[model samples]
Target chain A: MDMSQYYGLFISEAREHVRKIGESAVQLEADPTDRPTIDALFRSAHSLKGMAASMSFTAIADLAHKMEDLMARIRNGLPVDSSLFDLLLAGADRIGAMIDDLESGGSGRGDSAALIARMLAYSPGEQPAPPDREVVETSPPSLVPPGEPVGTTAGEEWGVPKTVRVKTDTLDSFVTTTGELITVKHRLALLAGSCREGGLHEALRDLGRHLRALHDQVMAVRLLPLSAIAERLPRMVRDLSRQLGKEVSFTMQGVDMELDRSILDLLGEPLVHILRNCIDHGIEPPPARGAAGKPAVGRLSLSVARRKDQVEIEIADDGRGMDPGAICAAAVARGVISGEKAAGLTSHEKLMLVCQPGFSTAPAVTDVSGRGVGMDVVKHTLQSLGGSLAIRSEPGRGSTFLLKVPVTIAIINVLLVVVGGMTVAVPLTAVIRTLEIRRDERGNVDGEEIFFLDGEELPLLTLGGLLNIPGGDGPGDTLAVFVAEIGGRRVGIQVDRLLGHQEVFVKPLGRPLSALPGLNGAAILGDGQIVFILDIVHAG
Target chain B: MMFRLRERRFALEVDAVAEISELLPEYPIPGAPPFLRGVVNMHGRVAAVLDLGAFLGLGTAGRGGSLVLLESPGCSLALLVEHLERMITSDDVGATRRGESRLLPVELVLADGMAGLLDVAALMDAVEKSA
Candidate 1:
């Protein structure tokens, strides 16, 4: 058998085993007596060693064998020490580097001899003293079920091959072809309306139904669980907490929630950035937290919720929270915003000031966040994906970073509104609700036109004026507007007319047009007219 | 390849030419610079059409023109020219005794007259910076 043909599979599986070993090590560190986690860590190391031996990669196999031997010792009633977990993590990292080398077409050769020697010489009875910090009463929950582990699904044993991998480009093309079919179906429906003869309308309706089914199936195939991107997060948080010398308990909910694979691909880095911010800037040291009459250990959590077509991911931390006044002062001192302008900003807006480019409230720059450029990139990335970031904090309480993103980026529902004869689309995620308010119902608040919706006053601004387009004068009776949230406030965007709603395939803008701000993408309508999808949060 | 954009001729490398087609109906882009002639649905992909004359600070390339689509996979962009003159071999280009112009990349002394060879990549960089 030509083992060369199986190199890709070997590298991929070996990586999964390595990741599992690291995650299990972290879990075992949190609960030293957890029998299932200890067994899991042992199994992962054993599996990795077997895989490496089959591939004849001596360096990797040697390192994995040592890790397996250590895990065996721990499984056979040897006491678990903190340094043992570090040794395990070190072994995982060394194997990870070797796998990376192999993936890059180099020999999986690395100098793990020192690490192996350390693992071999390790004695579980020689326990080191725990760090001088107040240990919390509660331990963080296990990231995944011990029986299933992080990388494996039920019935997906090694060499069993219950599922096959499909290339991402093939999936992408399927979406593109399906989207084109939907557009053609709409065009046919338009033509069918004119011909009352035969069953053209009925046949077109059936075609539309079948096309909708195909579109739904394609989108469903593109959906992947959030756990796919979140595989390394638990280990990452654990390592960073130890590095920063902070006793923090981190937990996550809704990791199994599914989202578009494309969205998940871009979302991982932003999620990492937010988590880094939480550990670095949001959480305080044990001494400071104790001095503030809080628990010695800080609590950090990420909770995800799906609402309609959008997903809200909230990352929260219980520590010495943000002070809006201090952030405002920092923005003024950095010349990011004028002092006069900062005074008029709401507390929520002041919290958002941390996302401004070149803005950092950290007293001194650290290696972890450096100059604090991550938040700005995180904000820009979310906005580019037609999502928004919001911050809520109290001076002494915790702070929460809310990220709102669409479920999928390929095809989405949009409310078509005509602005200045030309039509534009507002992604349904951004639209709160569409309304028609009579002229008499309008109110003037602080010399600005406002509309009352559900007893809440929202400022009304014309879409034409916002886009600098002309000829969007209303009928002088009722104003057609849709409520959208911008900067944590609801505003009524007035357009010429409402063209109802439709599901359109989104195409990314190319070149100079892509460089333009406030536009998310372009979509072609049934009439072959191109309309720009408004990034409503950034448009104004 | 040489093309005319408002009487003044501009030359682009033959290898850079993906396609040459008559004008397609364009839709206006909101919040875009004026020089952007808007976008067109090229096949199934959307391509931004730039009025080369206006972008070069001459004037609008105006109503009727041919689109010179660039062969850049990353950017589906096209340039509007009034008329295409002719395609010249690389030998002709190399044999030309012309000096590089400070305004554009280089000035190619063609059989008709002196035409500035448009560097699409550099032009794209400049456009991105300004836009």
Candidate 2:
């Protein structure tokens, strides 16, 4: 019987098995006696071998068969060692390549002879010494973070799946349709306001509530777990530490946390860059760590927390923290800034200088971080997605990189403000507070306007001036303003008037519009007017 | 398609014409170049409107004209033409003349006179570079 129809299914299922084997191998390396992970690794390999055999892909079957044998040996009282993980990972990677070849219309054939031989000859005799007590003490608590325990299948009954696989394009169109529906609903609400019929008003209110519920359900379907892109990060950390002669105890806390798939898609590269930076420059060699009276194994962690409409991802490492003075000096030397300019910057701003292009503190270029190209790309990527990146570090306590991003970019709540007779929007996430400050409350110091809020002095800037428009002339008894952080400084932006807030569907700018700076996206108002969303953080 | 931005006439290939419709309400794009008239909500998609008169240094395009939306992928841009003269096939024009500027290099010979064949791709590129 022809099996061409099953090729897509076989490839997808085979890919899943390969991913599971890789993930379980990494977990087993961290804890050798993890029975569930061992069982998972063995089962995935066994299933892969069965599928490859049925499909007549002998090269893949041969490699998986060897890996299954090795897992069985460990299950049958054979000692666990470092060689076992290397062999299993190599087998999974080889099978993965074969699967890729198959997807490209090849016969799924590859040269796996050396890998198969390694798996066949694997043993504990030549294994290095077992993990020392110090290393074991520093290991992560468990795969699951506290307060969220992993569920077990032992006590649960088997039932039908509660989910189904829908094409990503279909899901995207659902969001678009839902967003348009919301827009139409708004149009209806606007039209209904002119009529004084009580029944029409009541029905419009009900439609609004129903649309909100629909939006929630659609957004939930679009969310993908952070683990979708974070699965292979552990293996990467392992390989890099081994190459750099360093020992790192890496733990990830919120892999199960869900975020929009669009954000997740762009997130993988930045996460990889950050992890590489942590291993290459942030963490020190074991010997250097020992000399500094720190633990021989450095600690690195990635944690995620969801704020109202945003998510914050924190990547921290316990290694040599950056020296703000050194960074400022380097900036001066690199001509990225002047000596006088560097002297006036705060420590936080000094650290941010690392994100400037062509700024590299690394003494020698290596294959790892690629000459300080990591942080800037991270900052740029987050900014393009309407996000921000912040850094904090001490002299010795290590450094943390904080990344905050919106949960989804499709629809958002925006504060509508009239700037120069033209209505514009500021993302609610970017606004700290809105105030009607009295003219007497403002102070002019050194030719710059300043205002005090909560005892913190913030510079006052006109929104119209920033956008190169007109009408910031109202310095009357009171001024309308909104506070936002721009270039690491809190500034009160003066606008013509505050027109309240509304939820609108965001549409990405294309071509000439996309090339324009200082705008995040465009949205249509309920009255059929288009408003440009201001990227307040990055706007000039 | 032949269109007039101001007194000057320009022509784009019919294959690249997505839609020709009456001008819609437009919102100003902050910090954008002067040639970029603004953005308009075309159906549900937002498209940038380029004033050809302003871009070519002719003059600001007069309002209340038609918008010629281009069918280019990844670019939702419309040209604010004062009037869409009519659709003309390539057979009706002679093109072997390359002008100084690549944007309007090819010219079409109509019954009245010669009209420049606008290179939509080059125009988009120029907009990107300047914007």
Going through the candidates in order, what fraction of the true interface contacts does each contain? 0.78, 0.86
RMSD of 1: 5.6
lDDT of all the models against the reference? 0.82, 0.84
- DockQ per candidate: 0.76, 0.77
Task: Give per-residue CA lDDT, model 2, range A1-540, as digits (tens).
Answer: 687866877787788889888889999999999998988987787777777777778888777877877787788777888888888888888899999999999989999887766666666886343223111111111222111212223675545556555779999998888888888988898888889999999998899899999999999999999998889889889989999999999999988888899999998888888888888988999888888999999999999999888888999999898999999998899999999989989999899998887888888889999664568888888887899888898877789988888989888899999988899999998998999999889899999999999999999999998888886656568999999988667899999899998888888888878777788888888888999998888777
DockQ of candidate 2, scored on C-alphas against the true complex (2 decimals)? 0.77
> How is the predicted docking of candidate 2 categorized under the CAPRI scheme?
medium
Clashing pairs in 1: none
What would you estimate as the lDDT of candidate 2? 0.84
List residue ranges in candidate 2 displaced over 4 A: A1-8, A54-56, A126-160, A338-340, A371-373, A487-489, B6-9, B93-95, B105-115
lDDT of 1 by residue, A1-44 (tens): 46787687777778888888888888888899999988788777
